[model samples]
Target chain A: MSDKTTGNTTGTDNFPQENNESVKREMFKPLSRRSFMKAGALGALMIGGTATALLPLRNFKNDTSLENFFQQHYERLTPERMERILKRIEREIKERHGVDANVQDPKPIADVQFAYALNISRCIGCRRCVHACVEENNQSRNPEIQYIRVLEMPAGTFDVEKSDHYYSHETVPAEGKYYMPVQCQQCENPSCVKACPVSATWKDKDGIVVIDYDWCIGCRYCEAACPYWARRFNFAEPNIPKEQINPDMAYLGNRIRKKGTMEKCTFCLGRTRKGLLPKCAEACPAGARQFGNLLDPESVIRHILREKRVYVLKEEMGTRPKFYYWFDT
Target chain B: MKNNYKSVQNEAVPEFIRNYGLFLFQAIRLSFRGSTAFYAWMIFLSLLSFFGLRAYCNQFVEGLITTGMTDQVSWGIYIANFTFLVGMAAAAVMLVIPAYLYKDEEMHTIVIFGELFAVAVMVMCILFVTVDLGRPGRFWHLIPGIGRFNIPVSMLSWDVVALLGYLAINAHVCGYLLYMKYLGKKPNKLLYMPFVFLSIAWAISIHTVTAFLYVGLAGRPFWNSAIVAPRFIGSAFTAGPALMIIAFQIIRMTTGYHIGDRPFRLLRQIMTISLLTTLFLLGCEVFKEFYSQSLHNSSARYLFFGLHGHYALVPWIWTAITFEIAAIIILLSGYSRKPGSFVWLNMACILATVGIWIEKGPGLIIPGFLPTPLGEIVEYIPTYNETMVCVGIWAIGALIFSWMLRLAIPILSGIFRKKNE
Candidate 1:
């Protein structure tokens, strides 16, 4: 891909003649340094303007061609290409944003896999997961963009027993029910991907469904399509105070998202890709949340899935969610 | 001498009174016809929009945190308006299909009017969506081949295509018809069949795609149900056709022009069927939710009844149900079929329109997100700015509707009268 632009024969003739002519022309002119400098600046200005105009067009083609080659949706990218892309992403982030955002490229654990196991019994309905998600995913402080929600279900009934959605009090788990936190299940067969007429979002190799925020058009179709209600729309500019903004961002998953797009949790892919546990997993003080690679047999997630008789939130839908929950036996 | 004096006085008084009255009427008429009244209305809305726009700017600057929406209730009235107006746009096809395809003579006169309404509503829908977005300017990113097309994976792509296609079709057909009328030429017959078929297909596509947006969500149990698509179609037709009826009545009352009783009666029948379908669809959803009594049942219960102490949505839901029932009752009565009863029926239809808007719009999506997957409940309340922005968009739609009718109605009346002549 890089060779196509650099090695193209079309520019070689023009460049050789142009460089020789410029040198010969300079030798013949023998102008003072000041005059030569002025001429050079003028020439440079003209070249700069032309380049600026043509740069966008060239970049446009490059982007499209690159996207075409890389366009195997999300799941189709091979490991080698994914790695290269990750490296390229890290480089671009550093060069453009001037931010030291960590790009994760964790090797797939051989035996130890990752899966999310939620402990329904110990959940206090504090919604710490929701907060952690915002911090982890670098979400806009706009209350609407939360990637996870912890519903306060009442005792004896699993309904959305609202003790107070705005529960800011010191003592939580207020009286009746256990809290349940819901985020993207990273479904094995995500309906959202199927419903998309345009393949703007897809499950990456790491079992995280990621949306190219740049590609999303803020249509809310994904928001409506997600059975988990995991998708969120950036209705307004995400306003994380500069100080609070999470510096560690992912290119496709958790980079600072713009307005007018759909977003959801990618299991903190920005962190997980770097061999770090998701922020929500880290934030759960009660050990109610556990995340690990589902592909690893020796991982904690596999142990929980095997020994605890874990169940998915909505198994009847057959989404095959990677997230699981088990009662305390 | 006395008789002459009396005759002169009577003649002078009657002539002066008649001429003065005519002058006053003409002045009022001129004020309405020119840009004065129009600009006045524009300025008034602009002032309201100015304040709303300020709030919107604040929202953009401060972030969505300024809104009443919390994590649990991610969507609010903006989305509801988006859904409602899109349905309105689809419903415009009702006139397009009948007039162009089936060649329904009764509908031919009003078909362009319907298209005009569609253009207006679509504009409104698009505006509401823009306001709902975190970055409204990025909307152009959906243009294919230029921006990314996440084919088979993103509904946003489909929505952009469908909406743009529908708008283009409406614009082409309406613009051609209007130009033909302006030139005093007959509308080209060749365009009719293609347009008719397209309109029918397009109508279904718009609503179906909108439904697909919801049904595609595999995570939200309430929205994941199979009934969402049918319910959307049912409610859209009901509310959309009903809105058309109300619009017709408003035109009649304001202009003293008539669209004939037959079309009104025909629309009433359409509304009835739509309303019944909507009610049935709503019932099916309820039955499935309650009968299964699964985890999904809680969101439904919370919406219908106060979940815990938060009773905010319950009253709204009950109101929608009551009004919908009342609308059905009014439509079912024999008196409603009469020409004189059209006004009352229109009122009922208007109520049904609002009822469905509330039911399908905010009522559906907000509660579905309430008991978040983690069993957390967060209340969603739309702020005053959100409400104002909504009203501002509605006003823009109304403004578009008014102007489009101003242009189309006179031409329509002329065409119909010419045909008769």
Candidate 2:
């Protein structure tokens, strides 16, 4: 590409030479030892100037706090270290939100794989479980981050695309509508866990997928990778009134999330691991929600799995969700 | 003389390092010296870049709520621009392949510029990715050892490896060649040839891995097609070369550099085929989505035709399609080759460049999230702050390219050779 253009420019009356000479007349000086030294000094000055201009960014350390910002990932934290971290989180929450927060790191019970089964036939589409979850999990109230989305589908159609996510009806189960509340499925093969580049989220021994809020880079790859739309990102600082603050928080569960991290339903492992029912399950007024240990052969979830014609959402996506929905036989 | 040569050989490491350092110093000095117009352009770009920094600072302090992205539409224009620039970076391989593999003499001389362009675009890609991160401060968590690096499983890790590897490769190749030129020495084939070939393969991997970043996700049906990788390659070659054509022309006109018409002709030919392939792949995708008509087709529907009256993207995509069609027709008709019809060539190149930016940027990204995974139709519009940030990133890219070209033009023209030489 060079030879021809150089030839053409030369042919066009030494225009290239004139341009070069003009540049030389203005800015191009013959390189000398002194000039080289001057350039080096100038380069150093420029570099120093840029570094000084960016010095204010150091204030960010004080904001996120150096300790909280670089805290160890959940799995790697030893019990003593975890206790210290929990105290730090409690202090930070109390300082930030002006509330006494009891932050706990609840471990999954061994040999217990928690599972949930919802009786779709009994669901009234009241959306009470959605609000109950927010109150229990300490989700942001201003932008209203809800883990559960009660999709109202029309009668006789299994098409999720046709369902209404923001449906507002006057009464219970308006006419021919049915409600299917979807949250994190706690998948055995969770796509969100795989999509995470930092390994900040993982499937626990109890089948619940949990996120290390401190460790997440907030790239939102997991949000896009999830087929169930189970993942949520804190786009803004999470807002909760001091009174509404769920002081009983778990480290990998409903602990108050900072801005720019991924959060989702941990199947209320904060409660479930302690043999307490999930907030959503406990709040379902219709007695439609069921939660139990799937490993226990005599458990309701195991019986439901064996007998009920239960359906898993987006089963074709190959995410083996433990959350089952079955209509009454 | 023989004894002096022996002494120099003994001190090869320090001698070589000093010479390389001198070469870098000289290159930096040259970048500072340019005409009034060049200074004006650089200043303009600097202002834009400073504005971008200011906006980013605000975003940093206020959180992503300053941007339009929400939980529903998580990945927005930053990701869109990242995707497009990745293609631009990969496009440098088009020049590399012709220069090395085919031994096109015309391409060989100018391939350095292409690699330089790749370096600039790759920098932009990195910055875009960084700015998009919710916790940019926690980026260290992605480091291999200190942080948990999810490799071999997450396609994102593959992307990180591919992108950084490609950046390092191109930077090394450019640095080696430029330094060789500055030293008045022949660049050893052993030193750079293997790297050049690796880069050619690595370029394709960067785009393939980027596409796989989206393709591997079964959640987004719009990107789950087998043809996405092929389409990414197809569009990248088209936009990358078209950009080179325009940039080469500007360089030739301004600096009186000898950028021959041969590379332009070669690139235009490449574009003709690649553009056609891009359209054909688009046709295939459209056919499968509309013809089969499954529940998964809602995203495609939302992209091509609005879903539930949310048609904000409809005009944008159609405009992109029109531009591509027009550019393809102009190229195919041979109007660009006719005397005094270089305007047609410029128009076609610009059309193709902007067209692919839309098709790949907003057209591809926004739609993928639309009728979002759980069938929610949430439209993502880039706010002024977001758009300003993008503009700022592009200006930064332009500034980097301009500085590198300023240094290169003098050296390539033999005006700025080694001082003693």
Candidate 3:
């Protein structure tokens, strides 16, 4: 009701018949002083119209402050500036979700490129990893922004066209189907990074693609660019239960995201940057998910590449994704 | 004493600047408390526009979830309409090309209407982009110095530059010419002729860059074609001239502006050539997609025929194709040329307008994401919010065009001068 009457227009169309008649009487008055008054009234209407247009920003002004406006790019920020941002995140997490989160900014190690591999044969169709990822990533619960989607496809072929996502069956892992979970492949030549008109998202030296959420304008060009269907947008304010908020957070990883921003699986940067496994890998009951440094000669990903027939999705597009899938046969 | 002070202030301003402000006030004054029918039309559009504004507020509060788009069909109603409107904006160049190049005297008389229409469409284009943005508050991110506009890298950035530049050039040209017309003075050719020439190239660039927004996406095979840019220009030409021809008749009825038979006849020829080109381009695109049967052709296949029993878009694409074909036959026939055949001409024009809108809008943007990146077909049905907002944006455009016409007609017909005489 409040938004319905913008511009003090009092237009004849929205009114009752009696009211419209009166408005027409008022509208068809004589010339001279009235014309100037009408111009003045119209000027006021124009100003009111502009104010209504800007009303959406009022709810967001405090969240994205002057500091956020002036904040340097992720790569350009000094150690002190980075520390201030990390502290702000800590404060925001405590206030919004009532969780005392340790929001850190972990720099990439020298010459260590991240890689992932998932074994299709051993994987079960259970969706525990999907829920676990949401809680771990601090994703919204109201509209439910879950990062990972597991597809159940026919066993004979891997054609993505025939896959089903909204499945409900009697038992785990149906007879003629194989389950494959898909997320951001963290492409070495990530199109999402190139698609960001604001340079808000980029790949670090570690080949772990990340987004500076504060800097992002939420154009969704990146969302459209990703071939893996990896990106998720925050359409409204994220509504997460206070008790369930993840206390361990990373600035570019699983920290609480704002409304109208894009979030995706960042490989659990809070844990993985400390040399721990991604939650999806750790939660998989069938030991299907593998995460390791692609450059490390002894890493499991390197061993899988050397010993097995491994493949990346959409090879012709040449995204050069770090995530890979393999079969034991 | 007050008159002396006012006169001193007035003398400091340049004569052109003084007239610019004076003519704007005159235009505004003319727009108020129109005739009963005019009031009815204005009120109806205003009410619809306000309802649209209210719907946007709901969208802002409830998030984009209120709309029926998911990650699968990420860009929906807002984007589809945006694509069609850019074609509308670029259509003004058809008026410029014949008037300036061939120096056709009748075409020269109506060129201001096209330039003014471009300005209105430009406003609509910017509004659609803002509404589609997830964080509209962060609009400053596109401002070059304030934030990063990754020019030459992102096609979106290129589109922004092209669109805004076209608006500025056209607005300047129209403003200069119209203010001069109001003052009964010949416009200085040097001041505006250069910009008018530049706007022709700028017009083509706006739609081509918008096509690049979709074509550059390698992941979506549906849009990854060289055919996109040329098809964009062709469809734009067809729609633009067709709309202008209809508009001329309406202006004659409402404002007694005497546009004779020559103008509409010339525009009909332009429309025939461009519509044929668009249809031919469509044939090539369909044949390539059908013959090769590449995996990328799934979206095109989905458009023409049913894909996996998801036949929603089947009717829409066919209707558009049928309309275009029917309109062409009507134009090619002598019935359109017969005296009192305006009914047939109006039907053809309406068919072309709606057909091209359908072909460029939902037919182009939606099907591109049908078998999404993950090969899932989550069909998009634009929710009430999407429809209302879409309606509101269009009403806004109509209101702008109506107001521009309302303002221009009085001056063009010389009623103010006659009254003085």
Candidate 4:
């Protein structure tokens, strides 16, 4: 993505001619120690002035103050500059958060065709996925980062069942209630990405819609814009118990989210990047959640898509969600 | 000489003390006998504040666990209030433009009231946002260079700048005019006109940028439409002008201070145009959603006709439509055009204002987020504390409006003459 030497071409061309003229002028001048000292002093002063002029420009390049950062906007940042920014971010994280956060530059998983499938017949509505998500991603306990919502749809009825959203205690999924777990589908064309005026949210190369927390303004536009209600806003700082916070965190995808920004599941990119399964997939006692590369013909997701009678939520909208579900018929 | 001697004797007890005593007595009597509406509102807000404070305390003590919002419904009433109030703020610009730019004499009498209303609304908007935030102290980060503003990428940057600028301009323009009127002098016309133009452009920018904030998000299918901006502006104008009409009538009836017939007619005309535009925009939105029939189309359907019988928002949508239609009919009728129909028109305006508030405020934003990102629909009903905070902030805005009017109206009407003689 970067063409580094190409950037200095204009500067390189300007330097030679200026140097030749100076050398020619030097040849005509008398050689003396005193004159040389004077020449060196003048050269130093010129260099100092040029450096001074460039200092502000350099500061402009590095200054991450809110206003200047907002002024430059998000799309304008180059990859190298972004990397430097990430390093600065890591340094700040260490300084403020007091944890040595490992900042990894994980390239977007290529040709993976990541997709999720769920067996609605097997899901017992235990809410293990919700707890798993809170632990996997450093989510605040207050508002809670509930990436997956398990709806207890009544059996033999396609209609949404009357179930309390705040269902608690040891009561198991009742006789008639069938569990439906929902999260971000990692759509082919995401509406949340399109609705962002500042391009704060976008679909990465791997088809996951991700938000740069630093760039998001807590406008909650993305939260309102999503048809699936997938996005969540941090009205306050997410409170995660220190001991429970998963130390391994993704930079832009999932970290300790600040107050006044939007967040959602990124398919557990931080874990999936390291060749591990998502926490929800790991926590499912019934083995209801399935994750695999859809592009691989031998993968479970691909097999399910090809053989099983599978359906995506809101398929008619052309959002092209990667998540799928199937019945046990 | 006998009269002078008597007057001197009367003044021997110290005139300042006597006058001060009389002022205190009048204030005490007024407090005792006047309508308890203000105190009632205060008590209600206090109760709300107490509950809200408790909720906030829990939120701080335990984190966001105090609220019902999960990852799916991260945004609730607070955000809806933010968007709604931003629209309200923009609506207030209607009075500023006509009164200052066009120099409409009839609008001039009530324009400051609009400015006062804007100030009040903006205050509430900011307050709601503050309470909604996890770290309210971080708000100062938005100050131009202090915290980073992600400008072109974030409409929030523009929102912050515009809101602060509008507040400053309103204070300066309204304050100067009031001060001049108080001193019984002509206002400095030169200073106000520049700010007036700034305010006009600022008004449009505030609402348009807020619309852009929603439309910019590409991930959300429902919010990514091109129509959101125009729709927001239309709603803002309709709601704002209607509110002004209601306020004018209330003032007229209670204080017997008539703003005259011409101004009301002009306002009615503005409201009519705004309402028509609002309806047209809404029609376009409906057509687009139905015609496309894409995955994104489901949310609109859910909002209008309840997907899978969730049906919570159905009543609000119906109420909005009914009140909007009724308001338009009344304004367009021959009876509405009659001079004595101010009372009826005011009533219609009030209803329409309430309707639009419900629609744009809570109706549009919340339903769009249902059926979580994971495809699970979670029902969201705002807690009692949320409602209370909303009421309290609204009361705070009203208090500001009342105080500003109390100070401005007395001077503007020439009722309180200067002591120059």
Highest-scoring model, DockQ: 2
In order, candidate lDDTs are 0.67, 0.86, 0.81, 0.67
lDDT of 1 by residue, B1-421 (tens): 1232243345546754544443333223222342345546645655555555656665655455567765457667887788877888888776766665676665665667788888888888777767766545444455566544655556655776777788788877887676455445677768755765787788779877876766666557677677877787778878888888888777766543445555566677878998889898898888888888766687798899866567778989999998998999988986677656666687688789889988988888787776765556668888886787777678778877776665555444432111211
lDDT of 2: 0.86
Q: Write the per-residue lDDT of candidate 1 for residues A83-156, one digit (tens) a residue.
A: 77666666654554466666654433344334689988877777777887877777877444677767666677
Q: Tens digits of per-residue lDDT for model 2 on B255-373?
A: 77776778888899999899999999999999999999887888888888899889988898899999999999999997987753469999999999999999999888888887876
Q: What's each prediction's TM-score? A: 0.72, 0.93, 0.90, 0.64
lDDT of 1: 0.67
* Model 3 lDDT tens row, A1-329: 12122211111222334643443354334465966786687567656765675465455334666687677667678898899988987887777667898888887878788889999888888977898899898898987988889999988877888888887898879988999889889998888888888888888878888988887877788888888889989877888888878888889988888878888888887888789888989899988999999999999999999998899889889899999999895
Q: Per-residue error at B270 for model 2, in Å?
A: 0.4
User: How should the candidates be ordered by TM-score, best one leading?
Assistant: 2, 3, 1, 4
Task: Kindly indicate the candidate among 3 and 4 with the higher lDDT.
Answer: 3
Please write out the lDDT profile of model 2 over residues A98-169, one tens digit for every residue: 989888988889999999999999999998999999999999997789999988998999877788988886
True contacts kept of 4: 0.15
> What does candidate 3's lDDT look like per residue over B1-421, in tens digits?
1232243248779966655655554455467856667767876787678767867877776667778878788888888888988998899998898888887666766788889889988989998888888877777778898778788798888998998999999999987776665676677999999998999999999999999998988898889899999999988888878888898888756644556566677778878888999999999999999999877888998888968878889999999999999999999998787764478877888899889999999999899888888888988899998799889988898899888877665555443211121
Listed per model in order, the count of residue pairs whose N, CA or C atoms clash below 3 Å is 50, 2, 0, 45
Which rank order by DockQ, best down to worst? 2, 3, 1, 4
| Per-model DockQ | 0.12, 0.45, 0.25, 0.07
Q: Which residue ranges in model 2 land beyond 4 Å of their true spot?
A: A1-62, B1-13
